[model samples]
Target: MGFILLALGLVLIAEGLVYALAPSLVEHLLEMLRALSEAQRRNAGLAALALGLILVWLAFRFGV
Candidate 1:
């Protein structure tokens, strides 16, 4: 449990760094999605979900 918390903390820190350094990148991504049609927006959301799942799988596989 301690190790899991530590790993989660590190992930939060990394996410904070990226949020601080490139907030505009996040905004731009949202903007791009806003420009898409409804169906395309839904597809993009599904793609994001799949990507996140892949990342989680990789993290577990690599023991991180």
Candidate 2:
């Protein structure tokens, strides 16, 4: 539970930094995402989910 909270906090910080440093880029990215079809968005989401899971698994596996 602690780890989950820490991860969530870190994610928020990272997202905040992106918006602060490049608000226009974030807006452009959002527009591009909106332009994507439902299927495309689903595939992209699934890919990100798989990548995030693999990253966490590797981090624990390697004691990183």
Candidate 3:
């Protein structure tokens, strides 16, 4: 739980720094993602969700 909190905090800090220092870059990335085809977007979203679930399962099993 402590490690998860630490990881979440680090992610928030990094996300904040990116938003502060490269807002346009983030916007451009979002625009690029928006340009992806519907099928491509769906596939990407599914894959990411699957990966996240797998990671969560592994962490739960491994006590990470």
Winner by lDDT: 2
lDDT by residue for model 3 (1-64), tens? 9977987998799999999999999999999999999999999999988998898899889986
In the predicted model 2, the residue pairs found to clash are: none
Q: Which candidate do you rate higher for TM-score, 1 or 3?
A: 3
User: How does candidate 3 fare on TM-score?
Assistant: 0.65
Candidate 2 structure quality by residue, lDDT tens digits, 1-64: 9989988998999999999999999999999999999999999999999999999999999996
User: For residue 48, what is the lDDT in candidate 3?
Assistant: 89
Model 1, which residues run further than 4 Å from truth?
1-30
Worst 10 residues of 3 by lDDT: 2-11
- TM per prediction: 0.55, 0.94, 0.65
Better of 2 and 3 by lDDT: 2
List the pairs of residues colliding in candidate 1.
Answer: none
1-64, model 1: which lDDT tens digit per residue?
9867986898899989989999999899879878999999889889988997898799889996
lDDT agreement with native, every candidate = 0.88, 0.96, 0.92
Candidate number that wins on lDDT, 1 or 3 = 3
The runs of at least 3 residues in candidate 3 whose Cα sits more than 4 Å from the true structure, single-residue gaps closed, are 1-17
| Backbone collision tally, model 3 | 0
On TM-score, the stronger of 1 and 2 is 2
lDDT of 1: 0.88
